[model samples]
Target chain A: MRGITIGQYYQADSPLHLLDPRVKLLCTLAYIIILFFADNPYAYGLATIFAFAMVMISTVPVRMILRGMRAVLFLALITVLFNLFLTPGDVLVEFWIFTITRQGAQTAAMMALRLFLLVLASSVMTLTTTPNKLTDALERGMRPLKIFRVPVHEIAMMMSIALRFIPILSEETEKIMNAQMARGAAFDEGNVLKRAKSLIPLLVPLFVSSFRRAGDLALAMEARCYHGGKGRTRLHPLRYATRDVIAYLVFAAFLAGMIVVIRLF
Target chain B: MKLILDHVTHIYDPHTPHARTALRDVSLQIGEGSFIGLIGHTGSGKSTLIQHLNGLLKPTEGSVYADGKDIADAEYNRRALRGRVGLVFQYPEHQLFEADVFKDVCFGPKNLGLTQKETELRAYEALQQVGLEPEVYDQSPFDLSGGQKRRVAIAGVLAMRPEVLILDEPTAGLDPGGSREILSLIASLQKERGMTVILVSHSMEDVAAYADRIIVMNGGGVTMDGTPAEVFAQADALKEIGLSVPAATEVCRRLYAAGIPVRPDVTTAEEACEEICGCFLR
Candidate 1:
C-alpha cells in the first residue's frame, strides 16, 4: 500500500534538490503551461526532451517516476481511446461502425502525450522539493496576494500539514485493517456492499485517532506559541541564489523555444 | 496444538525499495498449554514471530507446523488456524466498533460460524473470563474506561475459543494497577483453561512474575530462550542487547555485587525480600 508515491519527496543531493524550491515550482508551472501550447510534433518532441532532461538531472530513479505515472496511465489511455474513436478526420482504419481517422489518432496521441508529460513534470516538483520547502516556496510566491487579505502563510501551512498527514493516516489505516483482519474480519471475501461494510471497523478507529491526533497537534502548537504565522520567523528563509536565476533563465529559454517551435511548425 | 516454526523468515515489502527483513532464519517450538513470555526491545521481530503462529503472516522461507500440519501448505485452512490461535494486538480496543460491548465481543465467535446461542454463550463466558461485569455488556465499548475497553477487546478474541492465545503488549499504555489486573487475568486464563498463552511484553517484571518460559528476541532472531529464572540469570548479557531484568533481579544483583549472601537469580519482589531476610537471619 505504501507504493502510492504521489506528493512524496525523494531525498537526493542532485542539482534539482539544490535548486531553490520557488524556482522549481515556477518552472513546473511553466512547463505544464508550455505543454498545452505544444500542439505540433516538434513542440511535443521538445517538451518530451525537456521532461527527460529534468528527470535525468533530478537523479530520482526512473522507476519512481514511472510508478507515479501508473496512477494516470489509465486516464491517459482513456483519453487516447476516446479521441481515436470520437474525432472527425480522414479515416485511416474502419472496424465495425468505428472509424480511426488520421486527425483523430494524431489528436489522441497529442492529448495522451500532454497528460503524461504534465504528470511527470508535476511529479518532478514534488519529488525534489520537501513538503516544508514546497510550502515555504508557495507562501513566498503568494506573498503578493496579501494585498487582498489572503492568509498565504496559513494556507501554505495547512496544505503542507494535510500533505504530511496523508502517509501517516495511510499507515494507521493499514495497522487498523491488519488488526481487524487478525480478528477474522474478511475484507476481501465479500460482495461490494459487504466489503465496504467490513471497512466500518477500520474507518471508525481511524477517524477517532485522526481527531485525537489533530487535537493533540493543536495543543502542541499552542504550547509552542504558534499564532497563525503572525510575526513568525523562519529558521531557513527562502533565498534566491545564482543557480536559481540560471535555472529560471534556462526554463524561460525553453518556453521561448516551445513558442517559436509551435509558430514555425 | 503444538506450534513449530522451522527456520522461518519474513520480509516486509519484499523486492521493493522499502524492503525490510523483520525476521530471519528463526526457529522455535511452542508446546501446547505452555505459558510463554516473548520479551524484546521495540522492532525486535517479536510481533512478526507471533503473527506467524496463526498464519496471519506467511514465512518467506521455511514452514510453520501447527499440530504436525504445515500451515504454509497451499491446502491449509488458514481461517481455521486463526480461529484456533487468537491474537490481541496492542491497543486492541481501538479495533472495537460494534454498537455495544456484547456485540463487539460476539464478532469473533460469529465469524467462526457459531450459532447465535453458542456465540452469545461464548461471548458471555469470555467477558466473564476477562472480569468485565454484566452491566457494561449493553453499553457502547467506547464509553468504557481504557482498561474496561481493553478487556472487552480481549474478550472479543477469547470468544473465538482459541487453543493458543497471543497478546501483543496487552497492558501497554495502562496504569500500573490496570496492567497488573490484565496480566493476572491472563495468568488465570492460562492456568485454569490450560490455554497455550504467548505474551509479547516489554515489562520484564510482569513476565518474571507470571511466565514459566521466556523468549528474548534481538535483531530479527531469537537471542535467548529459557525459563524466566534462567533467562534473568544472564542479566548482563540481556543488558548488552538493550534489555533489562526485573527490578527485583536488579536489586538482587546489586546486593550480590556488594558481597551479600543473596542469590542474584531472584526475580520477584517477594523472592528478593525473602532472600535478604534469610541472609540477615543466617
Candidate 2:
C-alpha cells in the first residue's frame, strides 16, 4: 500500500524542485506531445537527453522514477507484442503461420521507448512538484478557460481535494485492512469470487468513513467562508522565477533540436 | 499465548530518504493472561511493535515468535497467527460494516472458516462478552451510538476467540464514562478469559488503574518494563520522555517531596486515598 506514490513530490533542495510548477506542468505537457512526434533515433536521442537531464536536475531518486514506470511496463509490453505479431511489413522470419516483420520490430522498439520516455518525462515533473503546487498550476494554467464558462476553479478545487484525499484514504485503507486481517480476513489467499467477497468488511466502513470525512471537510471549508474561486486567494500564489525562465530556455533548445531531427527524419 | 519479540528492528520505507527506524532492537515477552499496558510517545514505536505481535508487519531485522514458532517463516500461516493475536486498531469503530451488529461481529469467526452455526454462536458470545445488550445486536452497526459501535468493533475481534488481544487505544475518542466502561470491560475480559491483553495507550491513569505490568517505549526501544507502581515511581524519567505518571502518583510524589509520609509508589487513587486517610486519621 505504501508503494503507491500518489503525492509523488520527492522533497529535495534541487533546481527542478525550485522551478515553478506552471513551468514544470507546461514542460511535461510539451515533452509528452513532442515524444509522440519523435519517429526516429535522432529525435528519440534528443528527447532522452532532455528527459535524463531533467531527471538528474530534479534529484528524485532514479529507482523511484523506474518504480513509477513498473505499472506501465506491462502496457508497453502488450503494445510490443501486438505490434510484433500483427503489424503488416517486410517479413524478417517466417514460421508455419506466423511472420516476424522488420517494420513490426522497429515499431515495437519505438513504441516501447516512447512509453518509457513518456512515463520518465512526466514523473520528473510529478516527483518535483508538490500536489498543491501542481494543482495550483493546473488552476492557474486553465484560468483562460473561464472565458468559455468552463468552471475551471470548481474543477481544480475538486481535483486538489481528491489528490489530498488519496494518501489519507490509502492510510485509512491500510488501517482497516490490518484491523480486518487481524480478525482473520484473508484478503490475499482467495479465489477471485472469494477475494471480492472478502472486501465487503473493508469497503463498507471505508465508504461510510470517507463520506463522513468529506462532509466534515465541506463543513470546515464552509466555516471558513469558502465560496468558489471568485475572490479566493492562495497562500502561495504561482510566480515564474529566473530559474524557471532558464529551464524554459533549455527546453526551447531541446525543442529546436527535436524540430531539426523531425525535419531530417 | 507466549508471545515474544527477539531484538526486532522495523524500519519503514527502508533505504529511502524517508526511512525511519520505528523499532530498534526492542525485545519483550507477553505471558498468558497478562494485561500489559504498552505506553509510548506518539512516534515511539508502540504501533509498529504491536503490529509485529500479530504478523501484520514482518520485522526488517530479528524475529517475532508466537507459541515458539517464528511468524516470519515462509511456511508459517500469518492468517492463523492473526486469528490468534487479534489487534483492534485505534478508532476501531471505523471498521464496522455489516448491516447489523451481530453480522458485523460474526465477520471475524467467519473469516476463520467456521460454519454458519459456529460463527453465529461465537458472535453471540462475543457480543455478550463486550456487554452489549442483545436488543442492540439486531440494529445496524452504523445506527448505533459511538460507544456501542466501539464495542461492536471489539466484539468483531473477540468473536475469533484470540489467545492474545492487542488494543491500540481502545477508549480513544470516547467520553470519560465511556472510556472507563471500555477499559473495565477489557480488564474484566482479560480476567475472565485468561487471554493476554496488550493495551497501547497514551493515558498514564488508564494503565495504572488496570495494567499489572507497564512497558514504556521511547525512541524505538523499550526504555522501561515493570509493574505500574515501579514504572510510575520514576516521575522524572517518565516526564522526560513526554509520558506522565498517574495523577494519583504525581500527587503522592508532591506530598513525599513536601516532607509528608505518603509513599512515592501510590499508582491508583484508591491507594493514595487510603494512604492519605491512614496518615492523617487518629
Candidate 3:
C-alpha cells in the first residue's frame, strides 16, 4: 500500500525546488495547455524535448517521474486503443469489425504521447514544490479573488490540509483492513457487491478516526490563536528569486516555440 | 495450540528502497494454554511476531508451525487458521463498523460460516465474557465510551472462539481503572477457558502481574524468555534495552543494593509488600 506516489513531493535540492512555487505552478499550467495545442509530430517532439530538459535540470530521477505515469497508464492506453480502432482513415489492415488505419495509428500514438506528457509535466510541479509552499503561492496568486469574496485563503488551507492527510488516511485504512482481516473478514474473496459491502467495515472506522483527528487539529489550531487567514503572517513569505525569473522566461520561450512549430508544420 | 517459530525473519518492503528488517532470525516456542507476555519497545518486532501466529503476515524467511503443521505451506487453510487464532490489534476498536454492538460482535462468527442462531449465541456469549451488558449491545458501538468500545471490539474477536488469543497492547489508552478491569478480565478468561493467551504489552507492571511467562524482544530478536521473576531479575539488562522492570521489582532491587536481605526477583506489589513485611518482622 505504500507505493502510492501521486501528489507526493520529492525532496531534492535543485533549480526546480529553488524556483518560486507560483512561477512553477503557472509554468506547469502553461505547459499542459501547450500540450493540447501541439498536434503535429515536430511540435510534439519539441514539447517532449523541453519536458526532458526540464526534468534533467530539476535533478528529479526519470524513474520517479515514470512511477507517476503508472497512475495514468490505463487512461493513456484506453485513449490509444479507442483512437486506433474507432478513427477512420486509409485502411492499413482490416479485420472482421476492426480496421487498422494509417491516420488512426498516427492519431492514437499522438494522443497517447499528449496524455503522457501532460501527466509528466504536472507531476514535475508537484514533485518539486512542497505542499505548504504550493498552498502559500496559491493563496497569493488568488488574492484577486478576494474582490469577489471567494475566501481564497480558506480554500488554500482546505486543499493543503487535504493533501497532508492523504498519506495519514491511507496508513489508517491499511491498519483497519489488517485488523478486520484478522477477524476473518475476506475483503478480496467476494463478488463485486460483496467486495463493496466488505469495505464498509474499513470505511466507518476511517471516517470516525478522521473526524476525531479533525477535532484535535481544530483544537490545536485554536490553541495557537488560529482564527482563519485574516491578518495571518507566513513564516517563509513567497518571494521570487533570480532563478525563478529565468525559469519563467525559459517556460514562456518553450511555449512560444511549440506554438510556432505547430503553425509552421 | 502449540506454536513454534523456526528462525523466523521478516523484512518489510523487500528489495525496495524503503526495505526494512522488522524481525531477525528469531526462534521460539509457545506451548498450549500458556499465558505469555511479549514485551518490547516500539520497533522491537513484538507486533510483527504476533501477526505471524495467525497467518496475518507470512514470514519473509523461516516457517511458523501451528499444531505441528507449517501454516506457510500452500495447502494450509489460512482462513480457518485465522478463526482458530484470533488477533486483537492495538486500538482494536478502530475496526468496529456495525450499526450496533451485537452485530459487530456477530461479524466474526458469521465470517466463520456459522448459522444465524449460532452466530447470535456466540456473540452474546462473547459480549458477556467481556462483561458488557445486554442493553448496550443494542446501541451503536460508536455511542459507547472508549473502554466499552474496546471491549466490544475484543468481543468481536472472541466470538470466533479462537483456541489461542493474541491481544496487542489491549489496555493502551485506557484509564487506570479501565486498564485494571481489562487486565483482570483477560486473566479470568485465560484461567476459565484454558486458552493460550499471548499479550504484547509495554507496561512491565501489567506483564509482571498477569503473565506466567515473559518474552523480551530487542532489536528484532528475542533477548530474554523466562518466567516473570527470572526476567525481572535482570533489571539492568532490560533497562539497557529501554525497558524497565516493574515498579515493585525496582524497589526490591534498590532494597537489595542497600544491603537489605530482600529478594530481587520480587515482581508484583503484593509480593514486594510481603517480602518487605517479612524483613521488618525479622
Candidate 3 — which residues are off by over 4 angstroms?
A81-106
Q: Give lDDT for model 3.
A: 0.91
Q: Stretches of candidate 2 above 4 Å error?
A: A81-106
Cα-based lDDT at residue A177, candidate 2:
86
- Writing each residue's lDDT as its tens digit, candidate 2 over B44-155 gives 9999999999998999999999889999999999888888899898876557888888888988898788999999999999999999998999999988888888899899
What is the Å distance of residue A200 in model 3 from its true position? 1.7
Specify the poorest-scoring 10-residue window by lDDT in model 3 chain B: B89-98
Summarize candidate 3's per-residue lDDT along A1-265 as a digit string, tens digits. 7876647788899988888999988888888888888779999999889888889978988888888899899999999999999999899999899998999999999999999999888888899998888888889999999999999989999998998998999888889988998888888986899999989998999999999999999999999999998899988888878888888888778888988999998
Candidate 1: misplaced stretches above 4 Å? A94-96
Better of 1 and 3 by DockQ: 3
Q: Against the true structure, what is each candidate's TM-score? A: 0.96, 0.93, 0.95
The worst-scoring run of ten residues by lDDT in candidate 1 chain B lies at B90-99
DockQ (Cα-based) for each candidate: 0.64, 0.78, 0.78
Q: Give a tens-digit lDDT track for model 2, residues A10-90.
A: 889898888898988998999899889989888988888878887887788898899899989899999999988899989
Ten residues in sequence with the least summed lDDT for candidate 2 chain B: B89-98
Q: What is the iRMSD in Å for candidate 1?
A: 1.3
